[model samples]
Target: MFIDRLDAGTKLAQALKDHPLVQKIALADRLVLSIPRGGVVIGKKISIQLNSRHDVILVKKLGAPFQSELAIGAIAETGQPFIDQSLVNQIRVDDSYLREEINRVRAKIAMYKTKFRQDKELNLAAHLTILVDDGMATGETMKAAIAWLQGQEKTHSKTYHLSPTTYLIVVPVAASNAATDIRALGVELVCLEESSDLTAIGQFYERFDQVTDEEVIKLLAKN
Candidate 1:
């Protein structure tokens, strides 16, 4: 367990130093996209360590109706989103409700993108993309984020105008099942821990405070 996000970030960076990706590609050829708000903290550290450009990925979870804590899928503001078909069926969600949820989530994503980011977007065709999050539970949000980088409508605040070539996922910890799901995405994942006993992500940390928007803006400014 880590003392805080900074401690987790340090450990993650140390573990990544010997990775073949770092050894093969020059750091200048990488771009990191962080899933805010906790993710930006770790992403900034990894970006600095890899000497890569960093940006934010604006994504929101599409929670199942009547149980908003349960995530059925996730959506990106300006690109294709992803949903778990099995979950949708299990929840007995109608097509009309699903469509409505997608629209609602997309609007929220757009607001976050506008509020947190500006005129810039990651041009994925040029550099190896890296998506960083604090950790993973269901992995739905991260999956949608990956799709955002690779899917159609590769545009953002402006037209991003590119397609994904190669990408990586980085995180401090994830549920054992979540790690498996992430691996199925066909992207390399660098995680500090994948534990079957992971009841919650905060359980693996000593000081897991909420990362505020103010903190994200400050870190991005420094980067």
Candidate 2:
């Protein structure tokens, strides 16, 4: 288990370096997108190790109507939702509920975008983009983030030249099922620990603390 975010970040950096793609691409052509605010901690360490660019992607979970913390899906900055159809059917979610949640999370994503990326936009064209997070639960949030990136990839590839290398996702820990789901995106996924019976992300860490927006702002400033 990791002692904290820094420790996790350090170990994750080493794992990323050991990947086969590390020798295939130039460091200048790589970019690391962190799912803040905890992921930024890991991203910072990775950027330093690989000498790659680092930025934030604002994606959030689309929580269930009754239980605000239970994620039925997730939404990205693009205002699109990635829903779990099986879960939706089992819970009998209506179209209206999905619409409301999509807009709600989109608004939150906008707020975070304005607060975090006030100066510039993330440029994924012609670069090997790596999405980093502290860990995953249902993997809804990360899935939405990847879907959003894939949307950009499809749109921008028609106009600009994209790299031939595959995209990547790295995390300190993740659920085994979620890891498989993430790999289904056709990206190289690197998780330090893929637990079969995962409960909480914090369960694998010795000191998992709250990462605030202010802290994320400061951390990004350093990079």
Candidate 3:
């Protein structure tokens, strides 16, 4: 198990150094857009190691009603919301409720972007954009993030006429099933460990304390 997010980030950054694409890409051409507030900790270390720009990509989980800890799916700041139809059906989530949740989450994402990010613009023009997170459970939020990047690429092509960014997902640990689903999205994934019996992300970390908004802001400021 990792000593903490910093330990995981160091290992992940080391693994990234061996990737063929990362080896070829210049540090200036790489951008680390991590999901906050945990991901910012990981991303900061990566950015420092690689001498790359660091930023946050906002996405929020759509929690199941009553069981708020259980994620139904997720919605990115931009792009279509990703919902697990099977899970929704199992939990009997209705369309109206889903709509309301999406709207609510989007608003929260907006507030976070403003609060945590201020007026910093998203750097979508990087040659390689690495998505870092503490871990992947259902992988819904990461998928939503990938979709958002694709949408940005489409919009960018019309104006700047540039090649699409090479998207990569990096995590300290993940469930085997979630890793497979992430790979199916066609982006490169670098995970330290993939376990079939993974219970929670915190399980793999020796000290998985909650990352605060202030910590996230400080990390981003360093980059």
Candidate number achieving the greatest TM-score relative to the actual structure = 3
Q: What does the lDDT read for residue 92 in candidate 2? A: 87
lDDT of 2 by residue, 1-223 (tens): 9999999989988888878776577888788889988999989898888888889988888887697766799888767778988888888889999998888888888888877888367766545777899999778888888777777777887853443246788899999999998888677788889999988899999999999999988888887
Candidate 2 stretches with Cα past 4 Å from truth are 158-165
Report the number of the highest-lDDT candidate. 3
Candidate 1 lDDT at 105 equals: 82
Total clashing pairs for each candidate: 0, 0, 0
- Per-residue lDDT of candidate 3, residues 70-186 (tens digit): 788998876368888889999999999989998998888878888777855676667888999999988888888887778878877754222433878999999999899999877
Q: Once model 2 is optimally superposed onto the true structure by TM-score, how far is the C-alpha of residue 82 displaced, in angstroms? A: 1.6
Query: Which pairs, if any, clash in model 3?
Result: none
Per lDDT, what order, best first? Answer: 3, 2, 1
TM-score of each: 0.87, 0.91, 0.93
Shift of residue 183 alpha carbon in model 2, Å: 1.8
Could you tell which candidate, 1 or 2, scores higher by lDDT? Answer: 2
The residue-level lDDT of candidate 2 at 146 comes to 77
Q: Rate the local accuracy (lDDT) of all candidates.
A: 0.80, 0.83, 0.85
